[model samples]
Target: MDSVRTCVACRKRASRTELLRVVVHEGRLVADDRAVLPGRGAWVHPTARCLDRAVSRGSFPRALRVSGKPDAGPIENRLKTLMDN
Candidate 1:
């Protein structure tokens, strides 16, 4: 069986490999390509819709336990890049 991790955006449990790994470092959200980041990490579906839902719903910010709204800039840009290439 695969390991499970709760999505930072959806607050739902999902397979670790099935979700994208995002890490908050230096107070900035960054996409962790290798899924190896020292600080707290957040999970989200690889799909654009999920990422959007996460951002608009405040799930990302709540899951990360950080104040202020997450602009979803990194997630959005990553999804866009994936679709473009």
Candidate 2:
């Protein structure tokens, strides 16, 4: 069976495959499409609404247990790409 994860942004539980996994890499947020990145990952829906909510509420750092603010540009770009496809 697929694992379950919670969206840090919406605070809703869903299957891991239904959410996007994000990790902090070099102080920046990166999308873990393969779910193979090293470090703690925070899951959120791929939709822009969830992404905006996550960023506005400061859920990334808290969920990933990182210090200060990690850059969200990379993940934002990734989400845009996903939306385009």
Best by TM-score: 2
Residue range 1-85, candidate 1, lDDT tens digits: 8889887665789998888887666666678878887866778888887787777787766777888875567767878898789
**Candidate 2 local lDDT, 32-56, one digit each (tens):** 9899989999999999999999999
Judged by lDDT, which candidate is best?
Answer: 2
- TM-score of predicted model 1? 0.79
lDDT of 1: 0.76
What is the Cα-based lDDT of residue 57 in candidate 2?
95
Query: TM-score of each candidate?
Result: 0.79, 0.97
Stretches of candidate 1 off by over 4 Å are 10-12
